[model samples]
Target: MRLDKFLKISRLIKRRTLVKEVAEQGRIEINGSVAKASSKVSAGDELTIRFGQKILTVKIQDLKEHVKKEDASSLYTVIKEENIQQPTRHE
Candidate 1:
């Protein structure tokens, strides 16, 4: 599935548009490489997300086109989450 779709359906970002914006800003990465909104994602892929003051890492456990609200969390596993004074971005 698409990175944006997975993020929204997994309840990670809540909206596809937001995912696109975030990805465009270099706030999203896949398997250690920068990812675009239309990037393709598969099970077992690792995602590194940079938020305002925090960074989140999650492993893609499964990809589902449609999932119940309660099962959204099943899509990915949270590997790490950290708060920082400044998020390092090459750009």
Candidate 2:
């Protein structure tokens, strides 16, 4: 499946357009490299998404064209999630 579609179908990004924008802007990475919206993804691939100050890392477990809200979490496994610490400014 396409990276953008996978993100939306998995309920990670909430919208397909947002997923595309994020992929285009280089906020999403797959298997340690920056990936585009059209990148092909499959089972066992690692995905990292940088959203604001939080970074979410998940491993793709399964891919589906559509998934219900209650079953969304089954699509991937959260490997790690960390909040990026901002450096304090000194005036």
Candidate 3:
């Protein structure tokens, strides 16, 4: 499945366009390498996504074309999620 579609269907990003934009900006990666919106993904692939100040890493467990909101999370396993601390401004 394409990265954008997978993210959308999995309810990770909530939208396809945003996924594409994020991927283009190099905020998405697959297996430690930068990934594109059209990048091919399969089961067992690890995806690291940076969303603003939070970073989320998930491993693809299944690739489904369509899934209900309640079951969307079944597609991937959350490995970790962390918030990026911003540096404080100093005078």
Best-matching candidate per TM-score: 3
lDDT of 3 by residue, 1-91 (tens): 8999999999999988999889999999999999999999999999999999999999999999889999999999999999999999999
Candidate 1 C-alpha RMSD relative to the actual structure:
4.6
Candidate 2 accuracy as TM-score:
0.96
lDDT scores for all predictions? Answer: 0.96, 0.94, 0.96
- In model 2, pairs of residues that clash are none
The TM-scores, one per candidate, come to: 0.92, 0.96, 0.97
Cα RMSDs of all predictions?
4.6, 0.7, 0.6
Worst 10 residues of 3 by lDDT: 12-21
lDDT of 2 by residue, 5-87 (tens): 89988899999889888888899999999999899999999999999999999999999887899999999999999999999
Q: Give candidate 1 regions above 4 Å deviation.
A: 86-91
lDDT of 3 at 49: 99
What is candidate 3's local distance difference test score?
A: 0.96
